[model samples]
Target: MDTAAYALLVFGALAGGFVSGLAGFGTALMALGIWLYVLPPSLAVPLVLICSVVAQTATLPSMWRSFDFTLIWPFIVGGLAGVPVGTLLIAHADPQIFKLGVGLFLLVFPTVLFFNRTPMAFRFGGKVADAGVGFAGGVLGSLAGLSGPLPILWASLRGWGKDERRGIFQIFNWTVLLAALCYQAATGLIELKVIWLALIAFPGTIIGASLGTRLYHALSDRNFGDVVLGLLFLSGVGLVWSTLGLR
Candidate 1:
């Protein structure tokens, strides 16, 4: 085994897992810096997927049976389709542009949400909106490890029910992560080493997500939303720092 690689993988798993719990996402954005230090970016992608799958799967139970399927299915269908396109886009995009785009979104999205008394709320115009989110997710997922965040951000800003958000995010993320993992694996980006690293993260992700589920119990709807959104902002800042070679 690669001792140094293994060590970083373990630590990354722990940090990534906790963040995933406290927030609904950020597992990849938080862990990627550390993972890339030991492994290639291509390999990092699948490892992220595996760890995310573990995290989201564990959290799905609390979210299950609480979703608006009319809403869930269409949006998820979009996300499922969106992720692979995003994955493919990632391979071809210019690094500088990619960095700038993610940076802008990270900096702007949360600020807008924080300042606004009310965001756009919901823009679903029947099934079309669902397809649009999926397509957006697929496109973004193809390019960046983040696909579900935009749709999720809308959900967060609108202050949807915790169970609905969790359930919706679980399906959206799971689909994106799984699809991205497949693309990486088929392209030979994933190796046994990565799988081992993902395995190491499994326990941590599960534990953290479980804690979040429990924490959800005591929070008022507004507090829970604030907590998750706050965590996402911090995570975004961390990513920006890392991208700038500061983290």
Candidate 2:
């Protein structure tokens, strides 16, 4: 890679890693925005998955106390089931339409929530609903390395505490992303060049994630919620702009 591409790659890794470490999810949301400018989707998609797994794994210990298998298994089961289906559909799906739909939802939903100031903790759907959200997350994860948003939104609506929400984001995304990466490898998307680029991204991801994890420990629950919502809003903007060629 050229110097410019290398710089962008590392910058993307740093940004994405920091967000993942801080929020327990968002590596792809942050990284793909920059990486796509320099790397093709095939390479960038799996790279984000790998880096996301790395960032999540690195910070897992910090969120370990919040882990509850009973609370998370439904999502995992649903997400795993969705991955191969996503792989099959990618070839037929229209990328632009998909981006526009997700981008608009991210834009509108987060904006409304950010301003509402009402704590929304709904208990209506239960575990089945959570699994359905996980299935959607898995499909998105495979399509664009985005398995966090749906579950994140659902957890927020469920009014989980910061650590509880982060736990879902971390463990759920780790499971889904790792599964997506494996599917990509099985389908030959993990090329030698992608591996080389991942090597280049490693140190930046580690450093950024380390720093972000430190900051995460200092934030209040309210502050953490605002930060996550803000990032989601910004991610929405990035997606819409890039998809519409306004970037």
State every prediction's TM-score relative to the real structure.
0.86, 0.97
Residue-wise C-alpha lDDT for candidate 1, range 1-247, written one tens digit per residue: 4888777877787776766665556677667667878877767767777887677777766666766776568767777677666766666787655655676676778777767756345645656766786678667665556665676776765457776676666677777777777776787767887776676778767776777667767777667666666756765676577567774
> Each prediction's Cα lDDT score?
0.69, 0.89
**Candidate 1, residue 151: lDDT:** 66
By TM-score, how accurate is candidate 2?
Answer: 0.97
TM-score, cand. 1 vs. native? 0.86
Name the 10 consecutive residues with the lowest summed lDDT in model 1: 117-126
> In candidate 2, how many Å is residue 37 off?
0.7
Candidate 2, 94-121: lDDT as tens digits: 8888877888999998788788888888
